[model samples]
Target: MREAGKTLDAALGEQAGLQPTATILKVIQLTQQHRGLSALVLGGVEGVKDKREAKQKEVDEAYEKFDALVKDFNNKAIDDAWATPKREWQDLRNRISSGAITVPESYTAHTALIPKLLVVNDLTSDLFGLSLDPDVDTYQLIQSMYYQLPYLTEETGKMRAKGAGLLAKHEATLEDRQVLAAIIGRVNDRLTQTHTALNKAFVANPALRDKLEAQWQSAYDLTNKVMQLANTHIVRPETLEFPGTEYVAQTTAAIDAQFAVNQAASRQLEIMLNDKVSDLRKTRWIMIGAMAGLIALAGLLARLIARSVSMPLQQAVHISERIAQGDLTAQIDTGGSSETAQLMRALKAMNDSLVSIVSSVRGSINAIGEASNDISTGNADLSSRTEAQASNLEETAASMEQITATVRNSAEHAREADQLVGSATSVAARGGQVVAQVVDTMGAINDSSRRIVDIISVIDGIAFQTNILALNAAVEAARAGEQGRGFAVVASEVRSLAQRSASAAKEIKELITDSVQKVEAGNALASEAGKAMHDVVASVERITGIMAGIMMAAQEQSTGIEQVNQAISQIDEMTQQNAALVEQAAAASESLQQQAATLQDAVAVFTLHERDAGYSYQSPAQLTPRKLSLVSINGIA
Candidate 1:
């Protein structure tokens, strides 16, 4: 169907391509007439200058139409071909209008431009696909329009130019006659070619022949007449007699007749191309409709097939969804022996298994809850007893601490008593040494008193001798008389002094003897006190040794008590830790009981068969209760 659409597009494009060929043909015809008129006017013919200007205008207008048509084609090669002719036309018109051109120059210029326009016509036909028409009738018609008819018209135009130029000059040269003869021969040749093309077109399509026969015959006759007139009046004669303006008119009439046939052929070609494009478009739509009908029929069949397979699968999906949502009690009817029925039976067995599994899980969860409760209760009782033991141990530790402190204080006091006894012993030993020195001083004082008594006895004996010497001196003085009276008084005074000296010495001796006796008594008492001090020093030393022993024993007792206290504290701390552990175990067991209850609640969401209710089953591992000690529980927990 898509390929048909492309063919239809191509046919329409070809039809569009044919549109510019008509304008191209029109430009060719107008330029040919303008070429003939240019020759006549430049030949100095009267009354033809205005005709030439007018024909030039007509040619320019046809060029405008050709420009518009070529623009639609958008083909650079065709446009370029048309531009050369258009430029030459303008230059010829300017030369003729400026009167700067001679007869041959003007005629040559116009002739040059007409062939360029013919080339443009051929190019336009090829651009429009007319030269390559697929059908025989259209192809023949294209040959006539693009080649045969243009060639015939060009030859006729040449005849017109030459004939008109000779007529306008009223003279004919041999060279001019030869050129006219040559143009005549070419004209005959083009006429034959044109007839052959038309005959071929007619044979190919009798309908085109019926439509174009009269125009073709008219063009044929007019072409022949123009040839005859040229041969007799312009080529054969040495001088010209026909009016140049009338000659241009007759030749133009022949060219117009040829163009008329060309137009008819173009119209027939357009009609045929249009019919071809229309048929292609109709066929494309027919194919499109047939394709659409086939697509609709396929879709209907596919829908019926999908319905047959999807319906059963949808039922199976629905049942599977129920199972996923934990509806284990859903019933299944496996009626058919198809694969889908087998799938339903599998799902039924899965549901029954789930019912049994869920029932067993529910029973296990209940048993776990009961065991956790019992464990929690036992932990609570153990916690109370452990706490009580920790409390009693705490009190015993406090008492031991007090005893340890008392023993430490007693040891400290004993140490202080021992230091005091050592100080007293040192003081007593010093007192004994002082007492011994005092006894030795008493003995020395007694010896000094005895020496003093011996000195007093010697003084008494000297006083007796002095008394006797005084008596002798008195007797001598009596003999001397008055002069000796003074000597007698001196002797008497000496005797008295001697007597007093003896008495004083006896008193000193007695006092010295009494002091020596007291010194002896004091020495004896100091000797006895020194011995007592020595004995006191010895007793204090013994007491210091005893106190030291007592202090050492007290210190050892305090150390032992402190070590016992530390042991009791450690035991108390362990008991506290045990109590805390018991509390933690009680809490953990309670949490386990709650978790088991939660598990039971979670399992309750699954709907089970009534026959599975109260169906308790325990595995061999769960038949007897497992007892775990505290150490094992601590490790596991």
Candidate 2:
């Protein structure tokens, strides 16, 4: 059906091409007329300028129609093929209108452009699929319209221009006669080809003959008259006497006649193509209707077949749904031995198995709930005991910590005391050394005091001698009268000074003796004190050694107590972890009990028998075991 639609579309597309082809043919005819009339006017013939202008207008109008049709086609090949001839036509028309083209040049230009126009016509036919028409009738008609009639019209146009040029000039050269003769021969040949093509079209579709035969004969007669007139008056004689206007009129009539045949053939081609498209469309619709009927029939049969299979399957599905919803008591009708019936029997067996499994699972759920509850209770008690043990261990650890701190402090104090005793011993030893030096210095000072006493006695003896000498000097001075009396006063003062010096020497000797005695006493005391300081240094050294031993013992004791405290703390941590584990176990057991209760409730939805002796319930150990996660201990993930 789809292929038929495409065929219909192609037929319609071909039908759409007909109008453009007709417009191109019309443009060909008008341009050919304008060509002949322009040749006549350019040959200096009278009364053809307006005719040429009017024919130009008609050509222009035909070009406009052709352009409009080409636009509809949107074929680049058609547009490109037409461009040269259209430009040439405009140039030729302008040259003729402006009197810039001689008759020969005008005629040559028109002659050159006509074949290009014919080429465009052929291209337009091919574009529209007219040249490739598959049907015998349309193909024959297209040959005539696209080739034969256009060729005949062009030949007639050439004859018209050549004969009209000769008649307009009122003279015929040998070259002009030969050209007219050649054109006449071509016209006859084209006329023959056109006849043969029309005859074949008539044979292919006799109705075309009945419709277009009269116009075909009229065009044939007119073309024959034009060809005869050209041969008799223009080609055979050196002098031309026929009126150029009448020749042009007669030749144009003949060309128009051929165009009328061309137009008739085109109309018939359009009718045939339209009719073909209409037939294809009808056939497409008929095929569509037939396919639709077949589809409907197939659908009906499918529906009936689906009911046969789906009805039983739907019943099985309904039973399965009831079983899925835990309604195991749904009735099963396993009547037939078909696949559907087997499915029904299978569902029935599944339902019966579920009834038994549900009963077993219910019993299992009850046992699990009771066991979990007892386990939960036991875990709770174990958790409480573990918590209490952990607390006691923590308190013991705290006390041990305090004892360890005290021992550490005692050790520290003993170390400080030992250091103080060591320092005191050093100071005492230094004091003993200083005391021994002081005793030696006291002995040396006593010797120096004895020397001072001896020196004082010698000074006393010297003062006595000085006093005796002074007394002798005083007697002598008395014997010498007044001079001696002055000397006597000096002797008395010297004697008094000598006595005071002796007394002073005696007092200094006594004081030095007293100092020596005191120095001796101080030396004895220093010797005793030095011995006492030496004894004190020895005692302090012994006390320092004792304190060092005490400090070492205290440090060892403190380290032992700290180790014990660490052990207690570790034990406390272990107890704490044990308590947490017990609590987690209790919680897990409680959750297990709740889940067991939930499972029991969930299974309660199924209706089951009181007992099933055929199937035995499996124990948890005998059944598949689920994977369990181990609780983390001591932060090990």
Candidate 3:
């Protein structure tokens, strides 16, 4: 029972350890299943980020290309808005003064300025859309730069176109000069506004300042040239030359600044995305490592628990095997306060009980053997006396003339024979009682043997259960995989121990079963012996009745003596048969004694602490007394 408890505890502990691990494993599997989805989400984020980066690059390239286009148009506009108008007016002034061209012809030449003026306005409009597209309100310098700068450029172009058109009449009129003067004033106003706005943009966005300063100077110089040309109105000196190379440098720097701003924003975004991806990868590996560590720890704990439980049980099983083999000398140390310890204690106690019972039974058998010897001695004496009587009766019959004396002698002998026969009947009755008691004792022994079988059966059941538990532990260990291999070996060893225990229990059970069968056979033999003793008593009673008849008929002495001789012969024959039966009974008792010795030897393997006094007994009369007395008188003890 205690062993079973230990096995059950171990089983429960194993299951307890495995259940959580199984749950954790299931949870890990569930989480791992989601890993793919999580990876997909991360991949999607990366894809979107990549796409955004690509789109940003495309936008940057397009903006740079557009800025270059604006730079080209801006360069042309500067020439047309300022340098072109100045050079044409100076030519006209020289032609009129030197008298090479008429005033009307100069007027027709002034029409040439109209087309350049219109081209300058077109360049200003294109700059607004390409380089200075409005994003914020006009309050911001960036927006004001786009709006006001283009407005100033367009106003300058218009001023040039108007001044040239008004002066192109056949005669120079006061009204035409007045209109041209107004145009010059407006152009100066726009130039001042454009310069102020450009300076503000440089201040607000300092990154563009270095590059914008040069362009601002170029535009300022162009404004001054346009103002000079407008003041003369086809009358300036021929010092006017288009500043085309300076205009190109300013436009290039402006375009480069805008492209640089776009590239910086895109690069910053790409760096942030790269950092985010790196952090996510680190986090993923960390999670995977943590999960693996937890699983390893759980497996380690399970292995430790399995070893702790299995080792002690193996020791207990070894001890139990010795006990089953009738080797009670085997002792076990219960290592600690565990179920296996309790089992060891229980087995020790059972061993002690068996030793006491075996010792007591040995004592009882010895006592019974002594009583059988006494019965055999008494039976031998009775057989001798009967033979003596038969010889004397035959001698008296040989002298028929001494018939009267012989008749009286025969009557006296008949009374003595009747008394002896009554004694024999009393002895036979006692022997029958003894045999009945022996039958009862044998029956009791059979019952005890049966009980021992039952105890063995219980042990077998415990072994079987332990075997099942070990098998279960092995299966759990197998499920634990590589980490569980150590536990699996332990479980296998435990299973082997259980099997050995079961085998020992089975052998003990078989021994007990055989013992019970022998006991039952002994009981049946004892019962038969009791019935035989009763028949012996009946035969003795018949002899006693015939003896009484001989005492009553003394006058027919010869006839009675003849009958007496026949009865004596019959008594002698019966006495000889009783002697044979006594010998058989003594032989049976000796055989029983040998069986008891064998039983003692079988149990002698055990080392007992103390010997118990054998079982109590009744007086001989109460315990197979009939067989005792029958053997006592039959000259066989």
* lDDT at position 548, candidate 3: 85
Order of models, best TM-score first: 2, 1, 3
lDDT of 1 at 579: 76
**Model 1 misplacement above 4 A:** 300-637
The candidate that wins on TM-score is 2
Better of 1 and 2 by lDDT: 2
TM-score of each: 0.47, 0.49, 0.24
lDDT of 3: 0.54
Residue 457 C-alpha lDDT in model 1: 77
- How accurate locally, in lDDT, is each candidate? 0.80, 0.81, 0.54
* Lowest summed lDDT window (length 10), candidate 3: 28-37
Model 3: residue 281 alpha-carbon error in angstroms: 99
Clashes of each: 0, 1, 29
User: What would the per-residue lDDT of candidate 2 be over residues 482-535, giving only the tens digit for each residue?
Assistant: 978999999989988998998898899789889888988888898898889889
Candidate ordering by lDDT (highest first):
2, 1, 3
